[model samples]
Target: MKRDLELLKVILSKVEQQPQGAPFITNKDFSTRDPSLVAAHIQLLCDKHYVIAAQNGDDKWSISRITFDGYDYLDLLRESTLT
Candidate 1:
């Protein structure tokens, strides 16, 4: 699990598009990814207030949703990517 900012952006975008406060459906809506890794990334995002994640569990396929801060972060990342 390396730091994958691009994938992080992707996750953020996916989650942000969902209804407010509703976690995105990782299994059905997004591309295939390692559940554990996605969870870890979500945790990192949570720490930054970029997303809201559930409690860590043995079930790796947990869901997360983006926040207002997340949209802001995404805009920042997008700018960085462009420049």
Candidate 2:
């Protein structure tokens, strides 16, 4: 599947909104989008070091927190939306 930048932003925003160290489980969250799609993007995020995630036995990812790079990217995304 193609990369969805908007979904990436949404995922980062959701992860950022969570309390520090809180785990954002892919299967439990993001009901509005396809589970597989979300999982794929989350894997991409983890691969890019944008977020710290752990893979569960069920093949779903749990995001613990956003990295500094993640925050930087998110900020840029938010800024772009303002224009």
lDDT of each: 0.69, 0.83
Candidate 2 regions exceeding 4 Å error are 81-83
lDDT of 2 by residue, 2-71 (tens): 9988888999999888886665656459888988788888889989899988888554878888899999
lDDT of 1 at 41: 78
Residue 11 of model 1 has an lDDT of 81
Candidate 1 lDDT for residue 52: 66
TM-score, every prediction: 0.72, 0.85
Clashes of 1: 0
Q: How many residue pairs clash in each candidate?
A: 0, 0
What digit string (tens of lDDT, one per residue) describes model 1 on residues 1-83? 68888878878877767786574555334458776677677777878988766654553434566678888999997888542
Best by TM-score: 2
List runs of model 1 lying over 4 Å from the truth. 21-31, 59-64
